[model samples]
Target chain A: MTGAVMNPAWALLAPVVLGVLALAGAALNGVFVARAEGRPALSGAARPVLEVMRLMRQRRRVTVAADRLLWRIGGMALLVIALLKTAVIPLGPWILADISVGIVWFNAMDVMVWAGMWLIGWGANSAHALAGGYRFLAQAVSYELPLMFALVTPAVAAHSLRVSEVVDAQQDLWFVVWMPVAFLVFCGSVLAFSAWGPFATAAGADIAGGILTEVSGVDRLLIMAGRYALLATGAAFAVALFLGGGSGPLLPDWLWTIVKTLVLLAGFIAVSRRLSAIRPDRLAEVAWIVVLPLALLQTLVVSIIVAVRG
Target chain B: MLSIIVFSALAIIAVASGIAVFRVDSMARATYALAVSFVAVGVMLVMFDLDYIGVITILMMVMEMAIMAIYMIMFMGMNPALMPMSMVHNNRWSAILATGIFLLLAAGALLVPWPARSGTAAPDLTVAVGEALMGSKMLVMLTVSPILFATIVAALVLANPRGRYDRWGDNLKRVCPDDPQQGGLGK
Candidate 1:
């Protein structure tokens, strides 16, 4: 199936759709939290809506000598990066901006999180916030290489960097079936970049919310929304790269895309809750020595298979 | 017409932010201003259909700048990097040098006897560019990269204070390596 670039007018819908998916992820996360705390699931699902309303009314917390411009920009950049990522991700047969280097485009956007998270911490001018920012960069140093290798595996298999071609290559056999290591590494890196679940040390409670220490009101709202949006975007990308995007029976292609993304997103949220936070310092050795090599091996295996098939 | 407008806008941003790198007081701001300048240049490359190079430029520059800002702040003596501080020093001579270089480059651009295009553009500019850069030297490229990586790994191993002997035992017979901090693996 040829993936056609949709009308430019549909570009506006990217953020709206991303926002909805993010809301669903948040609701799923809320459900997990509710079950853990022994609360009603329905109420937990509606909690994000109430949170938005509450945060909208709350006053923004201003820090002494804070770089407000950078702080605000950092908070807002996450959601913008998520939306930019969505541009390269096709929903079934339709895409926005069908660039030839879509995989690299997504990689570029994810790397922006390094700058964004650091600025969020640095801008607050608070000790904890700055520390949180540094922690994220440290964690990033470990995860970034593995993530890049994982992305390269799919591109190597498809012999194309375009998202549509990657999806098309998976029509016969899902890449996830053979490249489980890359798939797992991709999922883990998505969590790491989003600073969610086990990788949430950058915003850990021990550091008094870390990069989130000084933010409040709409600033806090934006950062929180950005985190969920990144998670949703990562899940959608994983579907396209590994799950054979829109290749399911009975349902239309677009619907299948949505369904697969939701399922993966839910898995992400639930799994994150199950695992405890990993300290960045501790993670560095394991990531580099173990995870990175595994990821590289996965890429090597995929490349060999592709070469053999050809 | 639209391409012209976009190109001009990006060029302006690149220059403005490049200037901002020295104008900004804080190290973080200066570092990110440089990042913005690079990002603008990267987008301009994308406009020229160098998609892979363009996107990789944005990826590398942002990551480099982020790390650089951290080191700049962390290693700065007297904590001046975190405080309000000038991003420039010896500014007068530097300005003169910068202007001299700019004029030279601009003159070269304007005066160079550039030949008119003789061949059609390739179907994929990324592949074309890659072939142009590496087609003949593919063996050298592949060989040198591994040696370079090996050197880096070797250097790090030698420099590491807590090597395997230190972590494990001198005889390398420890059940759990004695360490200052526990790793995620717990092994």
Candidate 2:
């Protein structure tokens, strides 16, 4: 694979591309929901558009003594953070920032979600929202370390933190083939951070929507879109970091990137739909005791291989 | 010109939000205001071309503040944190101490005779930074990190109210450890 192409003009396209991908993911999720209900798949696929329109027309809800400033910031930050994450991700050869610490940059952006989700919970001055926020943090503490090690595996194997270099290093064999444990952990972390699948307890119905309990209209719209966007971005980054990015037959590099992202994203949505939500307190033990060690061992194995090759 | 403008703007933001941390009445606001200040400083670090340090600073600081906010709210007496309570305490000494330290730092920054750039920068500053900081001390760092981690684990274990004895019967014959909350793993 060739080196990344840097152009400021391409930066403007990042959000537009992410939005489309997010929309597609949402539609896939809608289709899954419809299928479960024994309804037509096509109508379920169109549900996101309808939901967007319905939400646009819905009135904004305000709770008593809400911290409007922090609440609005929290609501809006997710989509913005998702957009920021895409800056470091290269679509085939085209990239926006191409910073030296692309992997860390992505990590930093995801970390912002902790603040955003919490603020959404805290700003409402409601019990459920606050409980939801705390749940997210609890879940985050478990997934984050394993995720960090998973991220480090590729960077260590490539001997560089640069995302493009990671893609280039995979010309021989994809990191996913050797680092399956890390990839699985990374995918699980993505789901956890996005608050999808078993990690959706933060917004679980038990807490009356948790962080989403009080949001309405545009605020609700933004948070929902942001979740899907985050899922899409995570899938895209997984492609670049593990799957040989844009390395495929017939299709162009950029198309390959999109194809891989969508496929993985659909898999995520389907798997999340199939699984039940795991309580944060219960998840803590399994994540630390089981997942963390496996991820660490995977990294250790990758490190040994890299050292031996050298 | 653009770089200078951006730097100045970030400096102003850092200072302003640092002040906001003290001034804000709400605990969440105060915590996030401090976060904003650190993020601005982290951005400034990026401007200085320490991309790894800068980004890591942002990541670590934000995560810390998020957890801190929870502890602040949880521990604050009578739930004053939820209410619009005064963020400051022992105002007089704190103000004096803050002013004194700020002045001392400012004075040191201005008075210190800084060394001039003697050679061109390394091609990869991240690698250069790692080598400069860790080359000779790699063994020490590697050893120290595990010791620190073990210390933390030991501390938590000591401080924990519930231990194996508390969970299981003293005879250790129970099939399941009796607990108020069930863990994901059946054991």
Candidate 3:
């Protein structure tokens, strides 16, 4: 909407940096989770990296009668979805794509993650993995509509589906201040879709890693890393859409972006640890009965406010 | 030149993946293959500057594929990979039918007199779609609204074999409603 406020040079590195942080943040979340569970935590911050190294060195494992091609595709797609999602986020003033319909682009990428997770589960050819896959699709179905509705409030408030325009519209007040319900529903859906924290039923430990039961070595590493990246991208998007992208006074715009993303990510990780995994059947009821109505209400209020203001 | 290259590549991808759909052994692979083909079409749509429609295409297709997989699992019974059943059937007749339809579509595309451009297209096509839906074409939405609601009702009815009255009672006094399994929320 306006001339570039951030250096174009930073655009290229932003995704790479975001990805690395996602990996690290995921590993850090593991540490937090370990400490919370009263288990011996890994020695240092390098634990996640070290774990990746171990996975790379270890021989890859495949389940009996596994569909290797689909498995590989599933494992890889998560990271790709995360990267594509981050492309729409403006780290400062410029985004990677800067498309007019950036918000929809983000939505499109997330929907791909639905297919990705299911693929990972189905490809394994194990009952656990297949069941896990089934569980996630239910979770995906449950949250996706309400999530789409939640995504719409900011777009309605700004009267633009472009991510940067949504940010620009928050000059006086962040949408989250007024649209708290949408924000909360958004946070819950992010957890649901990413299959992390409370919504991690797909990989709930009871089923011996569920969809991940048959995954091993480099594939597991990629899937795990990709999840963190997904979470990180979600946090980055939340920053742009709700927290007012790069809007802080003291720091450089990009710095604000990074800080806000990290804070939200950490908050997600912390919140996830406190909550038990939500069963799919239960989640479906809550998603349809509760969150769906609230999100629609939030959208209605935002639209009414926008019309009145105009 | 770039547009041509991009379009050709995407067209190839879409066709190949479409063929892969029938060829794939498992339902999961077919679902993904269709999704991939739809995504390629979506990207092609964006390349043509129909960004809003393109993204919506990608969104709806992914959700559809995911839902299809679930229905397959529910009705078909057992693992898709292990099953390995061919979705293709009626070989000669189906192929002939497909070829005839393709020819008809291609002929229509090549011979039909297209309408001339009316005005400069809006750069923000999302807004354009919104205005058309809310303003001039509001009746289209109104017509669809009841159908959409009916679809939801139909879906719930189809998916739920036993109604709440069956689970609870005529008086609706059952506390847990005899759930097969426990939910995350007690209700």
Candidate 4:
């Protein structure tokens, strides 16, 4: 139902590609973070996978008050959301589940991150961990409105909520140039939802790694992997939504999609290095007062432009 | 046959989780149980090809429960390792009320005739909903948005115990509220 539909087998390959991309992005983020802390970049790059090995060998530690069932659920939920979110983006011309409501699907999948983060926090039953969970919920409330507004702007410009349709609409004029505010808000919210860099308040170092403090062993590895996957998938979605998907001259569309995603992912990693973690409470106020209004205005402006053009 | 299998599996899950919501002792488990129930309903909707609405249902319910979990943690938080605590209250009344509502709903489902399939399920239901909202019912749809804003304002007021007066103090000279945590504009 999309342009230049390809063999369905590519769907199988998409996950592998996404996994590698997410790992690479995580490595890049590690390097940036390492450099900022005056550490060796090589170790930083290898850290995510290395941590997985270390965590695998380590015995699982459970807090006595911790809800074991919910903890595992929380850890699994993150990876599930990441995978679900990836299913929406068109890797080439088609995706695993190219549903008509692909944009909404992306949003829906992302909403699962809320449960994932909170469950892990609440599961730990520790003060710091619980606080981390609470922080993420507050942040989610603050950023969700702006994020929804930003997401809707592209749908308005494209005249469709489908990701492929949005990409198709951007063939002429990219939404980023016109919907700049929405793009900015989208980036900010993406960082927030993924708990990356500046928006990493939920897992900040202050409360002893926040929700992550009590988690150890394979559980920690899974959560970290899920987080990297979330970050990478979000970057991919940004490419599809704002950077005009695979639309570019002198290259295959799929290649362009990959390149754009990598660039955006690298930018995210670098940007996170430059900014310190935002305080969740302060962020809540700013989100409602500044970002939400700005995002709404962007949507209004885009809707008007679309109306006028039509 | 396939539809029957899928719907049966989904219905069983939904009902099981619904029962688990009350049966689960810990607050977190209860919240997740409710989430699981809602997710099952969402999946059932997807089975009917209502992708947009189903997905939205799943998203909204998960986020809602996650928020609920946070609130539970904030107020009644203790060591999870220490003891498993029961969160259910007004159990007898709740059970009776739930049973009554369930019976009423079941009666309606059995007594009332469900409408026959209409127009081959429309190729794209999302577009139809959008057109219905933006095309004819735009005014009604636009009017309801303020309710959401009202809810947000109301929630913020209720959640924040410290009022503006409490924060500013009597003289109104303090640049920042002396929140125990500190770190705002002043910091």
Query: TM-score, chain A, per candidate?
Result: 0.99, 0.98, 0.95, 0.95
After superposing candidate 1, which stretches have Cα over 4 Å from the reference? Answer: B100-164, B178-182, B185-187
* Native contacts recovered, each model: 0.89, 0.89, 0.80, 0.64
Which residue runs of candidate 2 sit more than 4 Å off their true CA positions? A1-5, B103-157, B168-174, B178-180
The alpha-carbon deviation from the true structure for residue A146 of candidate 1, after best TM-score superposition, in angstroms, is 0.9
Tens digit per residue, CA lDDT, model 1, A89-174? 98888889778899999999999999999999999999999999999999999999999999999999999999999999998999
In the range B28-53, model 2's lDDT, one tens digit per residue, is 89999999999999999999988899
Task: Categorize the docking of model 4.
Answer: medium
TM-score for candidate 1, residues paired by index: 0.93
- TM-score for the first chain in candidate 1 comes to 0.99
What TM-score does the first chain of candidate 4 have? 0.95
Q: Between prediction 1 and prediction 3, which has the larger lDDT? A: 1
RMSD of 2: 2.6
- Model 4, C-alpha of A235: deviation from truth (Å): 0.8
i-RMSD values for every candidate model: 1.2, 0.7, 1.5, 2.1
Cα lDDT tens digits, model 4, B1-187, are 9999989999999999998977877777878899999999998999888888898999899888877765664476476422567767788998899999999999999999889987676688888877876998778778888998899999999998887778778786677776666533545
TM-score of each: 0.93, 0.93, 0.89, 0.85
Score each candidate by Cα lDDT.
0.94, 0.93, 0.85, 0.83
Q: Score the docking of each candidate (DockQ).
A: 0.76, 0.83, 0.66, 0.51
In candidate 4, which residue ranges exceed 4 Å CA deviation? A1-9, A33-40, B73-83, B87-187
List model 3 lDDT by residue over A1-310, tens digit each.
Answer: 4445555576668668877779668777868867767777875455787788899998877578888888999999888888878778878666777778888888888888888898899888888987888888888889989989989999999999888889999989988999999888888888877899989989988887888998989889889888888888888899889999989898988888889988998899888888877788888777888889999999999999999999
Q: DockQ score of candidate 4?
A: 0.51
